[model samples]
Target: MFRTIFNTVVIAACFFILTALHAEAAGFKDVPKEHFAYDAVLWAQKYEIINGYSDGTFKPNEMITEQQFAKLLANYFELEIVEDELKKQTTTEIWSDEFYNSLASYGVPLNGYLHNSIRSQPVKRGVVAQAIAHLADAQQNLNSSIEFLLEHSISTGQNPKYENRDLQKFFGSTNNMTRAQVVTLLYRMDSMDFYYISDDAEAIHKNEDNNSLNERAIEAKKQLDASLQQNPSSSNLWNGNYRYVYQWGKGQYERNARYVTISSANSKDFYVRLSAYDGKYEGTTEGYAVITSAKKAIMQESIKGNRCIIEFEHLNNAIKVTEIDCSAERKNGTNFSGTLRKQ
Candidate 1:
């Protein structure tokens, strides 16, 4: 009888422990136990992907920022943010370099959110969908993310208008995403049809082949050779001073009177000095001492020395700057297009 009672008691204790764990998994008072998102909430909490507020409430409707979501994804993937790398990217100093680099490394498109001060703003639902779709290797169309959600039956279309309610509620692409919604989407990422596998033999082989520094050097040399073939000669491209007006959008332009003066050149580095004046604000000078390559040059404003990525397309007497990302240094509305010509 004593042995029988002990065994029964142990069994009962085990049952209680499991029941308590299930309850704790989705225990937020605000989230009903029978809510559709209850299981996803439980899964996220179980794996520490999210935490509740100090008051023990998971405010499901609260919006999440890009940085916050990025951090959560970083935690999920076990990627470490490299602070030094982020420092080298921008001087806006709003977000750490690691925050940007880590997201880029994981295939997140920084172009959508990197150009503005809106990184701290709440992320939109469409963007959340895009992130998930990209991770799942889904083909990205203009509406791919929205289509992914709809095709998977994750959301229904806009709610039908009812009497006395003219506002048509939509599950459209640009809707603001709530915390619960984002978590549910993340939970669904593990579904068999949506999950991405990194174990493909071709991918593994490519990764292994690219692992060597020597191999990367060789690839870069090949690119340089290819570029040289197209341009034929970069002989006069870097030796003298060039003047270019850096205009971005409809905003006040920058007067770069003496933009870049190359001092020396080699296969390793092309050292150059740059100078510019803010067209909107006279006497405001921005200068930079930078080392570039035959194919690309990057310059930062002298005041803070933030970064701007410059890609060069060398012509006979002029080097056309095809693209520039000077978002960190310039105010909104500055035109990003410009040309550099030998003076």
Candidate 2:
């Protein structure tokens, strides 16, 4: 009787170990129980795009850093790292040779803010938007394929819309995400059908004959207008300057400023001034840099010193900046200079 009991216990231990191993291999069993991003985490894991911590825990609720995300994307997409010296230099707070090259090779859009340092912060929705847009631009076929897959998934009942009544329960009573934007995202994912706006004479007369799409478009315009209102100078296509100061803590502060002006009329080029100030009196200097932008990507002699290039998407309002072999010099803990060209 004693021998039989011992054998049973040993068998149970082995079974539990096997189960744990399987869970780790699948990358799901270790994820936190309370993560809001559980679905996204599982999807990424299934695609072999991300991995859990070595300690058998997936910290799904934790914020991902910029460098970590860059590496993750680079590995998943099989981006190549260049071996040039300029590409390898790692002096600035944001500099990462491998990460930069990998991101560039993957056609990831680099904002003027991405210099040499990787930020340890939560990945924002806007970054996701930018990355997805870049991926869509890079592989046109991939976007359509993914879209079709999403459509099929939705059609097969994989995605279900929350009932209108449940919206308050799930999203809270005071949440401001418009019904239109929700429907639009869902429709694009094939999870929900578009809500039609009635065009009946009485309904039309009540609301000026606005259809659902028209109403949504108007809302979108309003939201865009509000954003522009916050940064009114950005509306000027030719010249603009904006500045903001933020306090972090005792003896720590920062001033973020940007200025754009016409650099050369002959080449139709524009120069942007980007600077960051630090400390109590804003007397301590952090860094200062200048970059140029133009319509074309080519390096025209008329705009030779500029190392940054700007391109507008077909939508016109969407802008992208690519930094080239720009250089910077620092002095007196407050003064700095750099040259960049806009493409």
lDDT of the candidates, in the order given: 0.49, 0.34
The true-versus-predicted C-alpha distance at residue 32 of model 2, in Å, is 4.7
122-188, model 2: which lDDT tens digit per residue? 2322333233333332212223323333344421111135433342222221211211222222334
| Candidate 2: regions farther than 4 A off | 1-43, 46-48, 85-96, 112-118, 138-343
Clash number for each model: 8, 17
RMSD of each: 18.6, 19.1
Number of colliding residue pairs in model 1: 8
lDDT of 1 at 211: 41
- Whole-model lDDT, model 2: 0.34
TM-score of each: 0.46, 0.32
